[model samples]
Target: MEILHHDVRAHNVMLGINCIVQLTNFETARPQSGGKSWPLKDKDEILRWTAPEKDSSETRYTSECDVFSFGVLLWEIVSQTRPFDKIKNGREVFKKKILIGERPNINMHMKDGHQISVASDNYFKIMTEAWSQEANHRPSMSSICERLRNIFHTNINEDEIEYTENPSKENDITALDPLTQTTTSENILTSNENNVKSKEEILLEKARQYHDAKDYSNAWSIYNNLLESDKGNAEVKFMVGSYLVHGPPYCQNNDIDKAENYLREAADDGYAKAQYLYYQLLFNKAGKYLKLAANQNYTEALYDHGYHLYKGTFERRDPAKGAESLIAAHYQLHNNALGKLNELEKRYAKEKKLKKE
Candidate 1:
């Protein structure tokens, strides 16, 4: 009857002999009366559990959010695999499809002497109701607990438990015991291992090889594949954006609009490099790309920005701005390059004096 954790993972849940469900992962949990919002930034993970109406700005989350999340957990427990695994970029896109009333498929089987069906329309109805987009329409935590208690009392049987599989293999479905139709641990483990891959490692290796050979086209292709695999992968997104911004040959010939799009995507994903690049590209259109680069905190970006500003390629000739940029460049220069920025600063000062005279 008591809550243990808000970040409940599969390993944290335990069923007791008295049919009591003990939960864990309550690091962020607060009293019901406390007006604290869950500090989650990525809505994608919670989308499947969220009600269709609650997807808006006006609706604030309560324990009902946990209800939605629990429905997904139940689905995972019954199905033996993560929901929407077959659907690429599932987390990012699940909310849109769920709002349209798309439901997870369920099937019926026999265990022991009892008939069990995890895919009952009633289950989906309850889940959808719990996840209703409107917070007011969704059931409260106490109500959800009551409903679950009733289901467990009626459906659970200690004797004659059996396991069976769903006819359709769309999801990893399995029956738990000979009498009870639920997913088995062995089947779930097998299905998970068979499906998921180390996408980051795969993409990183491809990029390394391509970059080493200076084959930017192939590098870009690998990065694009990774992006399609996991849109939330900020590192890959940044690499792809960097290639588009500074890549040679094919990428160079690509339209500025396309390059900007990729850079913007990376920037939005929180890649600092992408943010600097995006800022530069925006200013580049107005011949101010160089100055923006110098303003970046990174030394390399500062040097490049200073170089562009001093050259007056993007903006009107301004000796003062050029001198300031060069001074910044001088501070960032390492080893033998120190003289380069200093020399540029000296040259700009002389030019400014001559212009004034």
Candidate 2:
């Protein structure tokens, strides 16, 4: 039955009498078919907490994958912070970084300036093993249980901590196969004292993780906290405004008017993304904001602004300025701008040769 509980996260767990934990949620489960690969449906939000192998299309997943996820669980127990909390695109970046052997922040295990350590280095070591890249290298579920028992049962400041048998019940964590150096979104929510990281830095990181998870409501909550602390932050303001513009999944409602209010504020602060977004919201009527963004070397803005410069549609016709901006955009990975630059350069060369001839 434990094997059947495939999606083991905070949400799926249930508590019975005497605070016993029970794993629920078999949505991703399949019959014991030799731990082979299955067609992953749509990408799940759980990817924030999922194993790298499970995130892969190449490898077949085994229970070892669950061990990897358990590592994230341990992280949650320690940090109470979301995995990749500073990254807005969690899974995409997680895949790129984790697949390349990068793991989540491990600062929670030790404290230089933040609150005292919740879990010791020994526990951190065990977690790193769980999230090891090689699935076979991870400890079996039994070993994980045994080790946790040793830590809990031993006199390691039990006064500061409380342990529960079943993780499914209430706030108590059930230790099945905890291993990993980093925590993920679906793990237990842990909170620790201040560390070397500033409040805004910490909050921003968590907000990124929540945003990446598509848990927009929670992300917004974090955003609001930051906004209250620093009302003049352009990037944060832009994100909130952008959320309003995009609507649904990011925001509950698409309030363009409110979106403009925030976005304009960010744009006024000279934030390149905000300036471009404002230009877009105004039906491309405002070339100045677009120009402002392009001047800041914003890739999309450079391309569009260059296009307008060359075509004289919205801005004045200035081939020299257009070509210069297009050239810069070309190097910034704007394909259309590169193409336009190439065409213009070729035309210039041909015309020069013709004049000489």
Candidate 3:
């Protein structure tokens, strides 16, 4: 009765009404004693969620691999972020880092023990144990369930937990978008007790739809209107400014000066993304802003600032400070950051070897 969910990431996990947790998307699920799973070609999309051992061309993924993925999912739940989120080309970097025994920083952004619904120590143990590189060293699903039962002080049977199917037209349930943290029908940024969405919410959703549909002109118009109504909204300013910088045709796009002006305004208002974007455009002049954004734990800024500190790109070389910055970015699941750290570790190892030689 063992199941091997080839993809066990957070996006496939769903939380329904009354806090009913269900693991949907059985498209990739196979019997642990399976004959065949997904073809290797189809696995590119799930590279980040697969186990380290999946580097081989073999199609037979074991339950132990699922345990590895579950450990990653645990990291996702604790960090509330995707694995290797900011890495544009993660396959090569991910493979290299995994070969060097790198895993996500489990302690980063950990919530309070009570908030996570399990004692922090127990949760950590479970997550780390599940991630053991030796597949057999990983704990069994039953052991994990036992730990959960102990945490909750209840003898919860497998039958007691509900499993909802993936929503279909008949189900009338909208799946949550991992990026927006909202359902397709509504934005969670606003809540109305009467169940009626506010005008601003409606407009925000419309703007999002337009942007997603690549109707940049309409999206710009709506965001501009929203900005007019709420002049002090830093997020709105960032959206408007970003469109101007990188928007597609017919939306006043690629206006660097205008974009910089808007981004600078948003950056001054303490929006971390804006601060980082502003630094990008004014790299030679806005080193301070890069540091400011890095201080706020902005992932890109951390990677860039760490790179600068390490290579002295626009700052003095201080390998220690650079490593520290890269480590912070790595904790947040930045693959590029991990890549840099791996590079440093290898170099340090080589140096030590040379000294011994």
Candidate 4:
């Protein structure tokens, strides 16, 4: 019944036809319950997966502690790297960081036009909640297992696998030059013989080429022309919205109103990025937009919400609140912003000390 022990890392995991399990070194396995104190003489060994409060005489080990360890294990699997590897003698350092409310990050990549994380954000979020500082806040192992099962059930689609096996030819054909006519092969060969360019094709090609060259102005211009000609092209509208909102140089002007307008258009077309950006602008002004973005459970907007709470730039400043936001952002790849926030924390602490003087 023992699924894993303390010494186990992700490499020990074995996936069978129906069951996934792990084998661990029992020498490192401390009793999960009814332990008077950690029997290990060296604090370092116990420190590896122990929570910050584990050393306190008042604290006792429990299954909930195992849940914390499970969170670390999950982090290892997703990152394909050791937890807390960034800190030297990282085991203890990681323990301290987690005690102070640090959370492991989820690695992500753009795949098939969708952002995919090494582990789903929902899974990490559940694990994080289950490993909260207060013992009562932690979920029972059975509950954790149920939540994880639901996450996999809802997020993992067999249809995705099937679709990946046979990708749509439409996207592939977009790369083809319209001037070249071919029925079977998608290749578009260079031919001096062709002179005419279809308006739609010309706009698409111009946008693609400009994007490839990182020339947003020309691309924006071409897209604007296309939009004027065919105002109903949802895809073109989405492109213009995205370019106007996020495009470099010109778009960097931070024209929130224009950004909001274009982003709204794209969001209406169901573009997740546009929805996320629009939510940020709205949330930045007032809390009204939080419901819209939060409802979708958009990871980016969640990170922003947490970050705004942490920065307290436009709101109230609370380190604990900011730390919580940073922790949530960590799961969503927004943790990079925490470095500046941490510096601000140190400055605030120093100022408080000076005031006491």
Candidate 5:
């Protein structure tokens, strides 16, 4: 009888008497075929173990999904720790990593001072195969059972195996598949003594990755969550404010009022870039904010403030000071500063030409 254990996790497995292992949690289980599909209303319950496809509204629980969850369970057995233990939001994991085809690290558990044995290697290989992003690419339960039986029958002694060290930067762990690389999310999560990154920083990195990949909705979600967690965080405020101003597709509708409020908060909190952007939002009426940002050596702010001063766009045009600021911006490789300086010269020449006319 083909069965699909819809929910597969370490908690659902039981160790019976005489070392007999039995799987529990039949509440969500159904036959592999000929069952009424259930709607995905409460995905949060199994988001950590479910496959990437399970996040979709139209997807139905399948044997392949169970295989993916089993892969996570296998990792738990080998590592003796929960996957993504520090992360509370499973949806964030799905959006930031899994949906992009990244998986949990297979080698992170190596630091536990365990000897590398053939059985452990085979276990990791099977686990990775089961976690393949494409459901069809994952091995069936029968194939998984065969592999498990082979490992059990091999009778590899752990004591005879030589101890192996955890992977260092020079010797990074590569996945079994040639197409897959070392676990990116694991690398992000791994904290070192020298440069320990906070969870907030990791999320920000994920947000930037999403933005780079053009997954704007996820990026916006992460930023908004960060802001909610820390309302006074100037960096998140600037990011959220900028996103609200531009309003990328699937992010949200543009709300200038909200954008201005966020920008103003960040600006008042002494964020130089936010000060400059806030000035722009105010129709450049707040020259003080622009000047403050330029004083901080903000490249765009220097170029814009200098150009406006040179063009007499302010109450008192100081061509010398403007030229000074433009030169500083040019030294910093501000692309527009050189062009603006050239325009300044052309404008002066035009004035001389008009004198003759």
Candidate 6:
């Protein structure tokens, strides 16, 4: 479904917890068929932010209209002031002015009155391109995001960034964040609380890319950093622990004890996957961990926990009830578990026949 917000403007975007900007005011939002378009709507939006084509006639406005609105919104972001603030009757003036292709002037201070240093010329050029009269000429949202990323994070290598059109065939860098729009008040990431969140995102993405590229040593090195200390993310903990358990070639020669401990740490932090995987790996040896995962009804653990209950394998036995639960969970992906299920069915039938005879 192609969901249109209908309203795209500076005020519609607000900073939420963790310095993340979220879009609001979805009162006029509606879903369009994948390839179909929506007619012009939401005329009450800031007149300066409306696309020229949208204003010129009662033409069908598509996602491209939001692109035009975003171009004007970028002015609000850069100038940090309402467009045409100098003129009286600015509201009515901008509506007519935009129809003839007028747009806000890009400036220094952001809408919040905070001054920002220009990092790249492409930034302003991108802003101008978004306001291109022809909607087809405007850069796609993906392209806009990449330009914003390069500006936001200065060290971003052009080679590492993914492109929407005409992607390079050789050594393509798989994008970690796709279709996720993030906007800030220019210098917001530098603020104290948001800095930590920003660092976590950067480090997490770093580890993810290294892992995807099979740069195991570097991936593990980063994972190790995220694994240690109180600042470790639960996902990081689960990842290291799961990696240790499964030993994907990078983490081959699995460390049973370390995996259990790492996964246990995340389980303590209330991570469900960590609970289940840890339970599966250590249930026989560590019943407590099994119960921890079992409590969450983790799929594989449910089957294993029920199987153990049936056979009295490190748990209280109730063969009839447990077998029913075991078959109900029906974990077929794991070869060993599949074999056990088949064996249990055969044994159960044999015993039943013998009892009848």
RMSD of each predicted structure = 21.8, 23.2, 26.5, 24.8, 21.3, 18.9
Model 6, range 100-175, lDDT digits (tens) per residue? 6666666453458665546645677788888787899999876787667545545344455433343342453333
Mind giving the per-residue lDDT tens digits that candidate 1 earns over 93-180? 5655667766565442234647545534455556667656555677776566556644443344434233343245446333524543
Please give each candidate's TM-score: 0.34, 0.39, 0.39, 0.37, 0.42, 0.41
- Candidate 6 local lDDT, residue 72: 74
Q: How would you encode candidate 5's per-residue C-alpha lDDT over 150-253 as one tens digit per residue?
A: 56534333343333343454544454444545464355445332255455666667678878988776677778778876687898899899988887583558
Go through the candidates in order and give each one's C-alpha lDDT.
Answer: 0.60, 0.71, 0.73, 0.60, 0.78, 0.68
* Candidate 6: residue pairs that collide: 80-110, 80-111
Question: If ranked by TM-score, best first, what sequence of candidates would result?
Answer: 5, 6, 3, 2, 4, 1
- Best-performing candidate as measured by lDDT: 5
- lDDT score, candidate 6: 0.68
Better of 3 and 6 by TM-score: 6
Segments in model 1 whose C-alpha atoms lie over 4 Å from true places: 1-20, 41-43, 88-91, 107-125, 156-357
lDDT of 2 by residue, 272-336 (tens): 99999998889554787889899899999998888778767675778788888898898998878
- Model 6, residue 93: distance off in Å is 3.3
lDDT of 5 at 224: 77
State the TM-score for model 4. 0.37
Residues 175-272, candidate 3: write the lDDT tens digits.
44355435543533233334555455566676788788886766677777787777787877888888888857636557778788889999999999
Off by over 4 Å in 2: 1-5, 33-42, 113-119, 156-357
lDDT at 188 for candidate 5?
40
Give the Å shift of residue 190 in candidate 6.
Answer: 26
How does candidate 5 fare on TM-score?
0.42
Worst 10-residue lDDT window for candidate 6 reads: 179-188
